[model samples]
Structure formats: C-alpha cells, structure tokens
Target: MKYQVGQRITGVINKITDLGIFVTLPKNKFGLIHHKDFGANWLHERQNYHSGQAIRVVVIHNYRGKISLSKMRVNDSQLIDQTNDFLETKKENFLSVLAETVSNSQTEIKKLEQELVIYAT
Candidate 1:
C-alpha cells in the first residue's frame, strides 16, 4: 500500500527461501529482503525469521512494480553513541547541502533578474 523507499513498515513473514524472505505488508502489498541484506550471518539469522512472524523492515527499493526491503538499518549495536553520532552527522550534512543550494539558487535568480531589467530598459 503506497510504499516508498526508506520507509519503515511492519509485515508478517509469508515465506522464506534460500535467497530471501517474503513479507506480507498492509493492503496485501509484499516485500523481499535478500539473503545478503539479512546481514553477514544469514544462515544463522534464518532461525529468527519464520513464517507468521511479524517483522519491521525498511523499504530499500521500490521500482518496476517490486519492493525490496531490509532489516539491517533497523539493527542497533552496542556502540549506541557512535550510531547516534553517525546519524547526526549525516543529517547535518544534508541540511548544510540544502542550505548551500538555496543560497546559490537565490544568487543566480538575482543575477537573472538584473539581466532582465537591463533588457527591459
């Protein structure tokens, strides 16, 4: 149901295969998490993902009518502070980039406006 990349959703395990696990999402939507994405220890991880189990996953890809999901990003580590720092750094970097883009766009617009005034006169 109206899935987008990077969105976190909860679904039930519909089936599991050697390649990946299929989840039943809301409104009959479906998603798959490839074996490699299950982490470095996939075989062992299989025990944790079973049929009828409810799981939370992030939408990694939603293209060409298929939705790829992942549980890796939801995983936390013992180094909670490091994880928080990393996320904060990413968010700050994104905001900085956006701000720089807006500033540059404004400067360009002002130049264009000046050129238009010259042409009008």
Candidate 2:
C-alpha cells in the first residue's frame, strides 16, 4: 500500500496513452510510467502496451499524492549495472568519509583537552 521512492514494484498495465502508461499495482493502487520513462527502444518501437501486460518498475517519484514509476531505470541494463556500482561505491566511500570525520573530531577534542589543562594550571 505505502510505496517509497526507488522501491521496485510489479503491476499490470491498465491503460496506455500518448503521455504515459497506467499500471494497476497491488491492492488496487494505480501508478503511471511517463513517456520519458519508457526508454528509447520501447519508444522507438512504438509498440502498443496492451492491457494486462505485467511489468516491473521502480518508484521514481511520489509527490502531491501521486505515484510515478520508471520502467527504464528498472529494466535498462546499463542503468542497472551503473546503479549497482553507484550503490557499492557509496557504501565503500561512506567508511572513508566517516573515518576522516571521526579522526578530525578526535584531534579537535584532544586539542581542546590540552587547552583546558593549560587553563586549569
């Protein structure tokens, strides 16, 4: 029922229009995949997205009480690989940044402690 951005979801195509494709998600929830999210190949082909065609999509946006989905990001091979690499890189980079911040904080704390000792004496 409750959907979050970047969450992968499965649904059936309920309607297709020039603007976008409407998907029927679980619990009768509806979402839309805009023309921009259909990807180049699918758009180039101009294939009719028939009703009941099951699709997997990622929740790209949720705003003003509307849910927007992206089929391109979920299904694009390059994007998928890039997404994985990006996440891994972020995870790997987090530790280094955190360590640097912690080290700096410790150094500052030690300096303040030394100043406190001098002031006390």
Candidate 3:
C-alpha cells in the first residue's frame, strides 16, 4: 500500500540514525521521522525510538521515492493543550482584575456618601 502526504500510517522502526528514524512502511516504502520534528519535549532521539517499535505517524512530505513523517502532529496536540491552559489562566486574571476595579469603585462611593453626610450636618 502506497502512502500519501497527510495520510496517517502505522510503521515499524527499521533503523535509527543521527538524522532520523527510518520506518518500514507497507509495500517497502521507507519513511523518515526527522529529529527536529520530534517536538520540544522529546529528548534523546535514540532513547525515544528503538528498533521494531510500532508508531502511528503522519506523512508530511512525499517527493519521488522519498517520504517524510511527523510525530509533530502528536506533539502539536500537547502544544494546543498548553495553549488552552494559558488562555484559561489569562481569563481568570482578567476576571480578578475586573472584580478588584468594581470593589474599589464601591469603596469610593461609600467614602463619598460619608463625606456628604458630614458636610450636610
């Protein structure tokens, strides 16, 4: 079975090199999972991968006989999760600031009311 770009495929690690890991795709096509594309949290390319390990990868490039894969899609999911967490924290901060402003306004109003009574007496 031939794989195309944007297609997800399951393959086995056939070899590991400084550049990338070579996966044996169906029908003998070789796919490369590049070291740079392994995401920010990934450490030790060889330790992250091993011979005969099975992985699901998304194909990013297919040029002539050369095929490239990305575990980055999986990594991107983590980034998205982190982004969502940050957004939530920002939202909470905004709400807290708004509450503090309102509280300050209420305190000012009470102070003004006390001053008016003293002036009228």
Candidate 4:
C-alpha cells in the first residue's frame, strides 16, 4: 500500500538510536521517527520507548523513498498491550532470542572470514 502523507501507520519498533527511532513497516519498508518529531525534550522522552514496541504514528513526509513519522497525534494507548503482562514478557523473550541469534551470526561470520584468509594464503 502506498503510504500517503498524513496517513497513520502501525509499525513495530525496530531499533532506537541517538539519531531517532526506526520503525518496521509493512511491504519491507522502514520509517524514521526523528527526535524532533517526538516532541519537546525528545532526548529525555526517548526513555519511554523501546525496541519491539508497537506504536502508532502519522506520516508527516514521504519524499525520495524516505518516510518520516511523527507521534504528535498519537493517542495515549501507544501500545496495543500497554498493560498486558504476557505481551511484555513475550517481547522480552523475543528480544533475548534475537540478540542471541545476532551473536551467533557474528561468530559464524568471523569464522568464515578467517577461513577466507587461510584460503587466500
């Protein structure tokens, strides 16, 4: 679906960085919620967000294949399971598994690189 300006999208929190929060949208797209878009004192307010969290945001800009998002009009229920303990636990478990997978991938990549060096020698 073509996301138009002013459209509201439901996406998953992919990652959080100093630059801003990255949201994973459908159709293999990622949207950016810049710090300025968060609101006043985003630097401090950022603490309230985390990876794997589902959030509702408005599409403020879409240019050059980059989608910019804002939480200006987002309602108080930022999360579908904001008060669900089971979902919170599931999120934690999913993150833990994802982290472990990344660690294992890194180790495998290092081994492959070392093998390549041996082959080159």
Q: How do the residues 11-93 of candidate 3 rate in per-residue lDDT, one tens digit apiece?
A: 89999887878999888788998888865544655687789999888777788888988876744443233222234556549
Clash count, one per candidate: 0, 0, 0, 0
| Order by lDDT, highest first | 1, 4, 2, 3
Worst 10 residues of 1 by lDDT: 77-86
**Segments in model 1 whose C-alpha atoms lie over 4 Å from true places:** 75-121
Give the Cα-based TM-score of candidate 1 against the true structure.
Answer: 0.59
- Worst ten in a row by lDDT for model 2: 77-86
Residue-by-residue lDDT tens digits, candidate 2, 15-114: 8887888899888888999887656665663375688999898877778758998887885443333233235547668888778879999999999999
C-alpha TM-score for every candidate? 0.59, 0.56, 0.55, 0.57
User: Which one is best on TM-score?
Assistant: 1
Q: Please give, for residues 66-89, the per-residue lDDT of candidate 1 as tens digits.
A: 989888865534213222323455
Residues forming the 10-long window of minimal summed lDDT in candidate 3: 77-86
Stretches off by above 4 angstroms in model 3 are: 39-45, 74-121
Instruction: Give RMSD to native, each candidate.
Output: 13.3, 15.0, 19.2, 10.9
lDDT of 3 at 27: 82
If ranked by TM-score, best first, what sequence of candidates would result? 1, 4, 2, 3
The local lDDT score (0 to 100) that residue 75 gets in candidate 1 is: 50
* Whole-model lDDT values for every prediction: 0.80, 0.78, 0.76, 0.79
The predicted structure with the larger TM-score, 1 or 2, is 1
Best by lDDT: 1
